[model samples]
Target chain A: MADHEHKDNEQLGAAGFNRRGLLKCMAWAGTGVLWTVNGGVPRSLGLLGEAAAAESHAGGLTFLQISDSHVGFDKPANPNALGTFQEAIAKIKAMPTQPAFIVHTGDITHLSKDKEFDDADQAMKALKQKVHVIPGEHDVADADNGKAYLDRYGKGTQGRGWYSFDAGGVHFIALINVFNFQPGFKSAGLAQLGDEQLEWMEKDVKGLSSSTPIVVLAHLPLWTVYENWGWGTEDAPRALGYLKRFGSVTVLNGHIHQIQQKIEGNVSFHTARSTAFPQPAPGSAPAPGPMKVPAEQLHSVLGVRTVNYIRGKSPLAIVDTPLSA
Target chain B: MLRTRAVLLGGAALSAMLCAAAPAVISGGGPALAAAKAASVKIDNFNFTPPTLVVEPGTTVTWTNADDSPHSVREMDGRFKSAALDTDDSFSQTFSAPGQYQYFCSIHPRMVGKIIVQPAGKTSSN
Candidate 1:
């Protein structure tokens, strides 16, 4: 064990969380960042360490998903999103399964502020689990110059910012679709993948076997959730088409900050509830965006999803449990 | 800032996105047309501040798109639909008939809201 780990363990100062290879203090070109890795995935080491220790049991395809933390949002709905994110961590610690990996669909922070990123990283570190992420519109909202959201999260990604990885017998594809903001709406300029990304995707999937189950992680909805509010992706058809050959597919997104699920053919698309706040369901309001729920109801709406994988199971069962549930 | 406006306006239409620079003012198609009782609704991120509105019949309820995106006052469970408006574009639809008109943005169904067109000659105290 290293000096820090050995000293912290002796003093009982450390939470004894799985720090493993989580914090890779790699020296980057610009500012130095302590990049952490979990299960061969780079992650923000926040509360994940301690949280990881608490529920490091419940083995076999155990993973957690939290979306739309919206850290910088200061509104009546959630006065301090950072606080709610803590509440989410508390839940993760309480879970029976020490998930092998953690996935944050997008919108980790509201304004993509460096502080916000740090805060999210700090909180997630407690989990002590592998964390994979996609970027939501909010994260890139106030980015500087061309240092857009993708630049920060788009490491080793496709031209349009799409990337895929292999994990525990499953192929996870992180797609960027929030960029394809349609015309005549609130979205500025455009928000969608260009031709380059699409072509890469075709090539990316060509190597995978049809039997491999693919999990698509993105910020926007791959299916048409709500067009008026730009909830759905504009060029998702091509992206979805690439996955047609796959046997089982699960697409997870977070921009909507609500739970909307649909099963088409062998694919299942699910929009996760935001750990920050809950938005009204589709067609429940005059527009599509963040909807504030009452304080008491926050826990009920915010929670986690437990996905289990069996060698020869007919289909993967995804159990979404809200805090209230 | 745009999101706050949408919530404050109570789902009011946007002038920039919906009507191309023309502010969407509710149509005053009522007996008190000259004295149109104006009310504003807001659409934030993708939610209606007031998912369902209760207004007296003939009340000109204007939906303002205070958010950066365009929204419409389409009738969800009724016979009314508006074109996709851009940010700042506004749309106004006066309630001439008395019924529960569920409206939403055809472009974004999750951006759903309702207008309770009350019967004429009656006033909504609240």
Candidate 2:
């Protein structure tokens, strides 16, 4: 299996494809490849043919990630943002085996209006699985400063809607870094986890063994992607220090509206695509905003991510499938 | 400073021409009448145009969002703040004190700007 994966990597290199180019090609193809991790390294197992079979045989845990469903957005880039969000939900409903749960990493609403939140809630009700969510800057733009989002999703969460949970022997931590603009706070134009949350997180994982797999979810990229565009977190490095001892750590975030992945030691960071619209690559455009594309090519840039984990395996298999695919 | 007045005058003339019933204050107006009594900043492409503006005290500064994304104008010291402004929305704040007030978009904080308020009859050093 290792040799086969090595050959595939060599072939991709020979084709002159960088990592981002390879991901864009995979996204354009819409066939969706499956990734398997051995030790701390990840390898693609070609397409979904063998990956699907391996998933059923292992039958460990599968979960879905959908993000940036700006419900009230009506720009030229995508006039029907809510329509596309519903389409993404319909796609999830059609899957042969429903994931254990769904995690929406924020931007659930465009302007945090009551109608927008209502519309989002009604659409998400169609799915059978429960959804865990963190707030994006767009979701907390209400006049009262996040009161609307908290009233709906903050029943048991602590401090601006951050919490942790465990499923299938893997620990999951949901964080909120989009609160730099809230009253009584000052930040350097980037998302922040804050010192209070960092303290909570340090205690949250204190008792866990080093062997336990850790998964982190947040609205903005925990790692800095583009400082000029405010696409990264300010205090994430301090939070990451608390999780350094974990054997396998996977961090999932969504704010840039595109897919980006990085690996450092035992940690793998991933940003999911938005269901609403796409943004230009870092430094690719004058600034980051809704990027207008040909109507026919829109679906190729927007999609959903599915992650499967097998106990005792150090790596989680992640697959990104576009809407049209 | 001359170019800024020209652009404002041009905009005022265009608006006056578009609206036949509008007041005739902009037509044949001199430079004094077109002075920075009221200034405007445009938010477009995630940038605050006229990143630095000099105006007399009591001048009302209005920010207009032209981008499809939502943005808010917030004073760094919490002196003033505007709610989220959607496309085509406008927010105005009157600067009554002669001081420099730095602000940024609360949503996209990298987009920063400054409004320099000068005392009456005094030219702005900036």
Leading candidate by TM-score: 2
lDDT of 1 by residue, A216-310 (tens): 88888787666545666767788889988887788888777655555567676777777777775555675455566667766666656555444
Clashing residue pairs found in predicted model 2: none
TM-scores of the candidates, chain A only: 0.76, 0.89
lDDT of each: 0.59, 0.77
Displacement of the residue A157 alpha carbon in candidate 2, Å: 0.7
State residue A54's C-alpha deviation in candidate 1, in Å: 16
Model 2 misplaced stretches (Cα beyond 4 Å): A1-21, A27-31, A48-58, A181-188, B2-37, B123-126
* TM-score of every candidate relative to the true structure: 0.59, 0.84
Q: Model 1 chain A, poorest ten-residue lDDT window?
A: A26-35
In terms of lDDT, which candidate is strongest?
A: 2
Model 1's alpha-carbon lDDT is: 0.59
Model 1's chain B yields a TM-score of 0.64
Across residues A2-33, which tens digit of lDDT does each residue of candidate 2 receive?
23323444443322235444555653344555
